[model samples]
Target: MSASPLLDQLIEALRCLPGVGQKSAQRMAYHLLERDREGGVRLAARLAEAMEKIGHCERCRDFSEVPVCPLCASPARETQLLCVVETPADRLAIELATGYRGLYFVLQGRLSPLDGIGPRELGLDLLAARLAAGDVGELIIATNPTVEGEATAHYLAQLARQHGVRPSRLAHGLPLGGELEYIDRGTLAHAFGSRSEIPS
Candidate 1:
């Protein structure tokens, strides 16, 4: 028998999200319809509101419906030291660790040439402009240690040199190919404490 259009529509729409396959989508749709209509509507409404309002920070490229994120808005966030990350999730991880009092620059993505994400697409030019502003004294490259992460770090290091800013990278203590989101708070703190200067 054919599924009704409304149920199928939500399942199909949710499947567009990463890793939510047709099976999981069907399960979610059923749960929403059968068990949790109020919860489902709430989730859908909140998702819509956030998607419509949240946007990128013009300065550091983090999430900000406003002109700047709350962190960037704070004058006490040690703007002299900027930590570069690949996504907002990394920011949450670093925030959880709490040793990093610096501002952040989210690349928004990595160097995926196959995916057509180049330096320009990753906001490297805007980063270059920010570095040239002379407000920052140090740059911490906190991209994960995957192949793409390493490439992104290398690219940022080169750009940092061009702008005459000191750049550093987290020490290789975390496991290879591991994400910051998975690393524990203590380890992340230690990594921040022992960051090494990027060679010129």
Candidate 2:
């Protein structure tokens, strides 16, 4: 235990961050106190402000300071195509990696009955309402390639069909530049099974 209770508390608090263990937290706390007190103060202030002010967007459920996020409000986005992602980070990755001009609906999490996460928790009602509004013609399921993600995608697809919207899943297969020999068996099998004809 540290001589100072406050120092021990600070180290413990730092451990709350992902992948930060006791040793890493202690190192961070020492670094902040000994080398970057000003930076620490700024970080604390910003973190506090963000925790207080940042809220989910009313339409897309992405992090926002206002009722609707800028993406949802922007007219340039395609209203007919709505992409559903499990998290804000996933949404950001798609925005950065793709030329997709569609709007989004953040699921926040996939359905995991074991974890008690359900459709209600993931805001399916809002998505259903959006689909029923008749603007979206396609619902793109961008959930991860996991059991929970697939289950969620299936449920979303059914929901879309009920609303007369076409449901599509993001294609999953081999990675670009990855050789078939080095690929995992599951990925290889999936890629082989999902192989499409070459364009003329």
Tell me the alpha-carbon RMSD of every candidate: 6.7, 1.3
Off by over 4 Å in 1: 1-3, 174-200
lDDT by residue for model 2 over 1-200, one digit each (tens)?
A: 99999999999899899999999999999999999999999999999999999999999999999999999999999899999999999999999999999999999999999999999999999999999999999999999998889999999999999999999998879999999899999989999999999999
Q: In candidate 2, where is summed lDDT lowest over 10 consecutive residues?
A: 171-180
Deviation of model 2 at 185, angstroms:
1.9
For model 2, the local distance difference test gives: 0.96
Compute each candidate's TM-score over C-alphas. Answer: 0.81, 0.95
Please report the TM-score between candidate 1 and the true structure.
0.81
Worst 10 residues of 1 by lDDT: 1-10
Clashing pairs in 1: none
